[model samples]
Target chain A: MRQRISAVVIGASWGGLDAYSRVLGKLPANLPVPVLVVQHQHPSGGDKLPWILDTRTAMHVVAPMEKEPIEAGCVYVAPPGYHMLVDVDHTVCYSLAAPVNYSRPSIDELFFSAGHVYGPGLLGVILTGANDDGAAGITYIKQRGGITMAQSPVTAEARTMPEAAIATGCIDQIHDLDDIGTVISELVFGLGA
Target chain B: MKMPESVTDEQVSIEDIEIRLLLEAIYQLYGYDFRCYSKASLRRRVLHRLGMSGMPSIMAMTERVLRDQQFFVTLLNDLTVNVTEMFRDPEFYRAFREEVIPVLKTFPFIKIWHAGCATGEEIYSMAIMLEEEGLYDRAMLYATDIDKNVLAAAKKGIYSYAAVKQYSENYRRAGGKTSLADYYTAKYDGVIMDQRLKRNIVFADHDLATDQVFGEMNVIVCRNVLIYFDRDLQQRVFRLFRDSLDMGGYLCLGTKESLRFSACEEHFEPVVADMRIFRKRQLMKRETR
Candidate 1:
């Protein structure tokens, strides 16, 4: 019995640009599920991440406006200095609330919100990062009956994040950095499809 | 028997139902309408409070909120995110000076409303800019927030010295013509803003969710406040702002927010698109809401 995945949320911090490029580049443009990415950055950082990701991936990449509806086939990048959450109404909303774990766009904020909204239909992925932000969020997704994945710490540019997630003992699968995108595509699209 | 797809799809979790009841209880007991707020952020805040208070669940918290006025106030503070800084986004101020100031100069007397002006840092920033531009004497700034405590603090016009040091850098980057030190005096780890800056300002408790429009204004600055609200509540606030603005008046929102999806979108034209500064259209006749 295969569950239909509704959304994919990916989180990365240090060495995120290269990790995102390599992973997102593998997913086809016509992917059915919307991919939301939270990459740790400074509050005053440039808004060029979406454009850079767009150049690498086939899917449309955007830093969504407040309350923008979540659409399939587009990759949403969390804007700096704001916590991005998935509303129950299937729209993306931003909050100016105080930072969690010393990060505004905290991976836990996104994952917890998406997990609550999507429930069993959610897919949470933790990638290379220097912090333990996504560990708690992975636990949340697993408790919500959603699937969780982590890039193997050995292959990650920064092992702390994925290692932390794995330590939560919630992740469903562990894949190498090179195979993460392929695993995601398989889980979302199914092998036969 | 197989569960119907529609029934299963529409099912609400017990936790979600409890949160809804808590918000409803808050509205009924305190007259604070948070029912229309975005649930994701609200849930996080509520859960945080629950953890801190060591409540068994949201249901237990709801019961406490109903009976304990003090606990309710604490929950209200958590619900309303009041994290703000002076000249938080310098680029918005820079754009305001370049794009909106020229138009504001044409008006004889300026009326500016800073809705949801938490602790009044942004209001002071605006006052300083307007004073430098020679508009402060002619301007009456209304700084409002839902929290009366914050409003009282805003009236005092004092901030941490360390925070003010960072704001000075922002002030310079925001095209300040003179020294930021000229505006405030330092006193033992804290800086007191010039009392004159408060002369033309009025700090009041105005709830955007419930209160009616107070006056017609030349400019409305409500930044990062709308993100806390749901779509319907945001549309209601947008309509309120639209009706409150004079013809050709300016409306400034946070950088991440946009008027494109609101019902009043057609009534305003973008003055500084990147900065989210919009101008009310002159030709459109006002329609009663």
Candidate 2:
């Protein structure tokens, strides 16, 4: 069976905004899969991430809503104070849970769920975070034959998270945030096409 | 002290017992203590792992995680964070060269602890700096982090070509002797860093949160990593760094992060105040009086 990448799960922390802005902003509107983001931010306060991100990029962004089905060409964020998970039917689900890796809207939770539903059909990207939160989930995606990428530690504002993923021996590539869009485009165009 | 047979017993529900049991099971089975990670991050990481394992619930995931050692390793990767870049803060590199590298020339051998060295970028940056300063041959660099996965990547030294542009700029700002482009080869437009930079570099798994100091270091560069930690954790890490450094050693932190409010502030004197670099001080004879 031919594997198709239908979804992308990305995690970021610290200097993630610049990378996210570059990658997410450049995403073509006709993309075949939905891009889900988990950017670590304050629990009680967020400065209109969707708007800020929207201004920088072309991708239409919105925080995922409860029970909403995943959609292509749209970006879904794990809103503050929630762990966004994809349901069995590919619907987005949210919960008011305590922070993970000391963060709400954790990238691990989002990637893990996507890996479960999509298995090898998912692509997990771990970018600029301060702690070791996404390594395990990225490995899980790879275990199910999903593609995984980590930000080049040199380019990350905070290298701990990407370093953690790389340490797992599961990452396929390490790219700077600026070039991540090209990788995503390649994946979207389908590998080995 | 045995209870009577007629005593009523209350059974704990599996769901209620599951979260706690899973956390405990991970600790007992794998020995990567995650019991202290913030609740939200832990819950999020475990739940995601459960989905990836195809286990119906945390309990099922726990059973598999405990029984399968490999699975536990996978769980650890998910639970930990792995986001990083090399020369992340370009100014810091510039500061290191201007203020720190000059002082390092006096030492016969240099031991640098790049605490939280994710994917080895900073270590490589340091290697480049040391090489540029004619010190690479005499330096032993220790790149340590709790993330085993990233440590492995740091060892590989491969990167995407897209990053080279920013890295090139950062390199120039940090005072590069040669082209940053010279560091890696172009393969399918992807970048593979020079293997020479990794020489004498040891990438290992060490947690600053709970683990004791592994070796004495001449300088410790634990940058922006401290911002994520609470005050107590920061204090603990500062103490660890203090203990790990030799007298007259150097301590470097992230641009926004500082040791002024830390419990161990008195132990270090500012070397480059604005850059957040500090030097371990030898107490004056008058202080003893």
Candidate 3:
């Protein structure tokens, strides 16, 4: 049987961060699912990931820990220069690999792995980015019977990414950044059902 | 600065002086401190702003920017580069575990700043560390970036499932305690990170290029985000980060980034030397930046 959504995965670049913050900030503390973020970033150097998100919203955001068991109601970010994936048993995993699309934390890497692990239980969101990193991943989500959404062109900083996903005609909703929270909430709690 | 002669019919007009005067007018009318930015980059960014605003000349744009705060804000958006992410460097996280965590155990309530945290991945990564180390409950992480759009993404904490897999092995090498899967449940095709990790974080739009100091912090990490700047811009940022550190506070830089050539290099000693982590010297009093 298809389980209700237990996790949400988001991919973005360019103008993505601001949009993500607003949506995550609106989510209440007791959200039913966990969230994972994979943003395209440089692979070497810098500070901790959790600290950045902690200040942006009330959500308890943290970077993925190698070998850490995935749990609901928390947020996991992919570390830089590594791919963020889910193990068969639902634990977070990271790896260093050659850049896909010249990006270490390729959105495709995260989406495909999660698609394999979560099957029909996943929900994917592609936000504003400069390139088409998440296009193939969105297709994977759709094929697996998972819900998919993209940022509307009106709100995207660089509409190329969301537009690319939309071109496949596989996306369920193309939402404005401001309205994304509603989509997530509805999916997470089966709200309005 | 030498005055440039705009001689027409033997009448000498100082065109260069007018440009300097324009900059001063911008400063006086608006609070933007572009006076110290590299002349070339500032010129380019200002020119771009001018084009976007459909001004016929820099003089006209300057006049408008001086009058409207919103215009200045738009100019500010173009001036700063707000590009970054969480645990931006996989090796840096690995090194932090190997080198820094052993020492961080001494602190009670750790205060950290992700300076130039364009999109806030660094903030999220640090919070995860504190949690794994049992320090999160008492920790406060501050993430700042100049770009409003990126800051919003850092706040959302949602990602696609396919792309996150790229970092799977990196997580395995970083000493992740459980399957990465346990932290989030998959949906549609993406993963929404858990909210609890963000509890102690505060993401704000801050500019190291022009903004004043925020507060003393135990660690300040500004990564690959700074390479886009010129030497002078780098120096200015280094000074700001230096001023914001508590005694012996840690400073982490991008892998390709270093403090060796920075004006404030002497202010800090290497912690994880190879990882570009530094410890601020205890004796260095906070300078009046």
Candidate whose TM-score is highest: 1
In model 1, the runs with Cα more than 4 Å from the true position are: A191-193, B1-12, B283-289
TM-score for each of the candidates = 0.95, 0.54, 0.49
Off by over 4 Å in 3: A1-193, B1-79, B185-189, B229-233, B283-289
- A96, model 2: CA deviation in Å? 21
Arrange candidates, best TM-score first.
1, 2, 3
| Shift of residue A176 alpha carbon in model 3, Å | 54
Distance (Å) between predicted and true CA of A158, model 1?
1.3
Docking class of 2: incorrect
Write the residue-wise lDDT of candidate 3 on B64-108 in tens digits. Answer: 767887876666666664444445556788888778777778877
Per-prediction backbone clash count? 0, 40, 133
Task: Single out the weakest 10-residue window by summed lDDT for candidate 2 chain A.
Answer: A91-100
Per-residue lDDT tens digits of candidate 1, residues B28-144?
998888988988888888877887898898999999999999999889888988878888789999999998888889889999999999888999999999999999999999999
lDDT of 2 by residue, B1-289 (tens): 2211211112212433676788788777666666554333355556556766787888788888777878877777666655445566677788889888888898999999999887777788888889889999999999998877788888988877787676787788778889887777888867878898888888888987789986788999987566445456778888899889999899998654667556687889998886789988876787532
Task: Write model 2 residue lDDT over A1-193, tens digit each, in one string.
Answer: 3458888999998888887988886688878888888888874364378778878767778754444568888888776656677755576655443456777777777776677677777889998888988877787787667888998999888999999989888888888778898888778776625
lDDT of 3 by residue, A11-99 (tens): 98887667778778777777778888887776544436567777776667866544456787788887776666665457655444345
TM-score of 3: 0.49
TM-score preference between candidates 2 and 3, better one: 2
